[model samples]
Target: MAGGNFMGRVVSYVVNELLVNTLANSPAFQRFAVRTSKRIEDASNLAARKRQELQEQLNDSLRKFEDMSQKKH
Candidate 1:
């Protein structure tokens, strides 16, 4: 019974080591992290583009209004 217990312990340790090593080398985990980072970058870029477009539109309208006012004056 003691020898059987010792063998079980050894098997458990080996399995644990294998799991840790496999996880550390996991390509899927790395890809997931990379994809998450790219998504964040794309989202930020999209927000910036929207903001710039809105600002340009606002500027154009303001300029047109200013020109119309000046003409009336």
Candidate 2:
């Protein structure tokens, strides 16, 4: 009984590993991974652009405020 159980466990592990390896190497999974990676990269670029724009706006506002303060003095 113990030997039977061991064989069963080994078979199960092999089957599961093969299934995982097959799925990982599949064309569909590869395409999905590429698309997901591209989307993440695009989103990161967009966030960086937005941050730069905000920083520029903040700088312009600060410059204007400083100019006004200089005029008052």
Candidate 3:
């Protein structure tokens, strides 16, 4: 059982190394990685902008409500 476990680990390591080398050497994989990274970055930036816009809008609404309350008082 110990020998079987050792062999399984060795096989897994070799298969992982082979896959890493193949993907590292492949031009198509490199291009896909770059495009995917750029898309993720763009999405992150857009979400940040949207979050800021929403915060600003909420602040404006709060200010208007405060102004209206002051007028009633």
> TM-score for all predictions?
0.60, 0.71, 0.96
Q: Give the whole-model CA lDDT for all candidates, comma-separated.
A: 0.96, 0.98, 1.00
Tell how far residue 3 is off in model 3, in angstroms. Answer: 1.4
* Model 1 TM: 0.60
Candidate 3: where is the Cα deviation over 4 Å? none
Give each prediction's root-mean-square deviation over alpha carbons: 8.8, 4.5, 0.6
Per-prediction tally of clashes: 0, 0, 0
lDDT winner between candidates 2 and 3? 3
Ranked by lDDT, the better of candidates 1 and 3 is: 3
Backbone clash pairs for candidate 2 read none
Model 2: CA > 4 A from native = 1-20
Greater TM-score among 1 and 3 belongs to 3
Candidate number with greatest lDDT: 3
The Cα RMSD in angstroms, rounded to one decimal, for candidate 2 relative to the true structure is 4.5
Look at candidate 3 and tell me the lDDT of residue 10: 100
